[model samples]
Target: MLYPPHQPLQAAAIPPQRGPAGPAREDESGPWHTEAVCRRDEAGLFFAPSKEPTAARLSREEAAKRVCARCPVVIECREHALLQPEPYGVWGGLTAAERRVVLARRRRREMELKKAASAPRIAAAG
Candidate 1:
């Protein structure tokens, strides 16, 4: 079943996705945390509940990203999500899988840069 029959239609509706709400908790006071545009949105949209179907989850994630696309602090949010290596849900306009692709590309670029940097030194030493 795409969704449990008992689940209300509203349950699948897209809501504004955000970070932890209310006054910045002591532990969440980092600059990115405070600056997040999602802070004012509902936190649930970004996360998939256990057992969510693949189709539903994809729809939900896209909805959450719509909010991210309009956010002012999207760059900070993306950086935080990438650095945290968040393993689930949608954050900063990208899903977990998309983040993986980006991370892989970034790693490849970093390795190439490192190799380039070392080549000059290696040649000098030889």
Candidate 2:
């Protein structure tokens, strides 16, 4: 379920991947990445191993999110995660499930805007 923005994130989190530091320096690839707080954190802290208990997964995700909360590049991190549609891990202080919800909302809003924009044109044409 969705929680209020001010409410501290709880439950259902994932681990982040290890990558080079400081705003993803662009190389041959055009995409740029922001510095992630999780980079300094231990990998095990973010993700649970296979067959882990539900409680353990929840705890690990919570720990990862705590780190994300303190991150300076949180917005950038979140944008990257959302764009990449990061399949796993808590990026930008949000769990994967949370991101999915966010994405769905975005899609719905976009569709509404598009439909609204076209309505006038359709009427004009008619």
Candidate 3:
């Protein structure tokens, strides 16, 4: 169900469960989630508390990313986030802002690819 299940694994994304509970892993969403490192850490570490101070939030995010760094399922987690376009929290080591940037870049890249594919090819005069 997640990203067609055939794409090559890459670093980074997550789902809309970006609430205070953090990322959600369903029993049928496949087994990659069972191995997430974030599962062992506090959910609050990934989601920001309302009205949290800037410095504290950054520190917490860094900590969460540290956990994600060693995660074996980081790629799956990140892909989930990007596909779902998770609106908040950190997933697969990326903060919400970072995910937005990534999504934008993906959109731009997709457009470029589509344009290239649709362009006319020039023939050589023999």
The lDDT per prediction is 0.65, 0.64, 0.73
Candidate 2 lDDT by residue in tens digits, 1-126: 211122222321222233433234344642222245565567677556799898988998898889888877678678777876777777788888999999999999999999898875535564
Listed per model in order, the count of residue pairs whose N, CA or C atoms clash below 3 Å is 1, 4, 5
**Model 2: pairs clashing at backbone N, Cα or C within 3 Å:** 14-89, 14-90, 15-89, 24-33
Please report, as a residue range, the 10-residue window in candidate 1 with the lowest summed lDDT. Answer: 1-10
Worst lDDT run of 10 residues, candidate 3, spans 3-12
- Using TM-score as the yardstick, the better of models 2 and 3 is 3
Q: Rank the candidates by TM-score, best first.
A: 3, 2, 1
- Residue 10, model 1, lDDT: 58
Best candidate, TM-score: 3
lDDT of 2 at 65: 88
